[model samples]
Target: MLAGLSADYYTRLEQGRERNPSAQVLDALSRALELDADQEMHLYRLARLVPASRGGGGREPVSPMLLQLMDTYAATSAFVLNRTLDILAMNRLAEALFSSFADTDNLVRMVFTDPAGPEFFTEWHRAAQSTVASLRLAVGHDPHDARLTRLVEEISAASPAFRQLWEQGHVRGKTAEAKELLHPDVGRLSLTFQAFDVRDKPGQQLVIYQAQPGSPSDHALKLLESLSANYRDHEDADLP
Candidate 1:
């Protein structure tokens, strides 16, 4: 009945050491492993002995160039995030821009699970929908990721809003966005957002935001910066 394949064979199949499996074999294996779309693609590639293309300079390690670019945007908010919505890093501007996020690492979690998050987002419904769609896009790129699955389960369990949005099954591509942000310190800031993929990591994104020059938004940004600077100093003094 082929009830089970040996662990050794399964490992070889996953590692691409055993190639040229027939269609029937792959189907059976996929069924056995309960592979999803991305996992199925990975399996097909392995069966064909196709090597995954390397990223530009290799799997991304937070490029120095990107860090330098972020430095140049001191007045604008910017963050580097991988496909799974794991925040890799952020600039001072980003902290001031999305100040609530400074305390949390996961953007998705912040949007759904945090009590203060809803109030922070003026257009909370649209923001929540977009976040779920973006997560679906990430899943399309890497369906086998355990962290992604865990996040989905956690959020789905904790937030009915997340569950509803996720069930809609909307897929999306990376794109620029504009937001009307209302920060406690900044008041209201209309900002333009741009997202760039990290060349070295296929699904990573570098998100940057700029307010239109010479607007009240610019003044609001400065106020947020001053507030954050004051908080930072207070925290430092309280530290042992």
Candidate 2:
């Protein structure tokens, strides 16, 4: 009654018999579910506004405009990630801040498969749990996505931590939070992050990290910038 959706229709939706929902119906359902902004967005994606991952290369589709936006952030480290936690794009500083993205392309695998996982993520338990939860949210959007399925299988087989978390069945959407990391060059750093939604492109998030002004992490950022410059000058490699 709240959504003016008939009981039979709602039942059909729940029973997987109804696939299409009008925009107004979707709005009403969002209200009925009492979804917050992020949850509402995730729900729409789950309803297939945009698939979890599209056909093409494994990377998420990053538009030139988005790439330009990422380019604008010189001091701030920024990157784009897909629902599956694939680090699709990043500015030079982000590569430097996170150590190297050449090997850790996928965050899920990085936290589990990489030998330096514990060292890289200072908060290992929290990072591991959050990665699993975020993946759970992503899977809801595209249950049959082959790449995501294979990733789950691989992580399950490799990481006992991931396997235990996966068995617990938790779902959490990505949210902005202060993150602590042990950077190889700069020692320990504290950074705050924002996960922005690409509204026109669902299932894609633009993440930016910032350290507090005048803090040790802030100084470390400057050092990372220097390293980034040197790498660019010498290697001429593209940012990950």
Query: To one decimal, what is the Cα RMSD in angstroms of model 1 from the true structure?
Result: 9.1
> How big is the positional error of residue 44 in model 1, measured in Å on the Cα after superposition?
13
Q: What's each prediction's TM-score?
A: 0.71, 0.76
lDDT of 2 by residue, 39-93 (tens): 6666666677754554323465788898888888877999887878898888878
Which stretches of candidate 1 lie above 4 Å from their native place? 1-61, 230-240
Cα lDDT of model 1 by residue, 1-240, tens digit: 352667787778668787667777778877876776655655565455444444321124677888888878767888987766767778887876766654657789878888767777778887887788777765544556677889899999999889988987665544777777677766777887788877766667888888888889887877777787788899999999
What is the model-wide C-alpha lDDT for candidate 1? 0.73
Backbone clash count for every predicted candidate, in the order shown: 0, 0
Candidate 1 residue pairs that clash: none
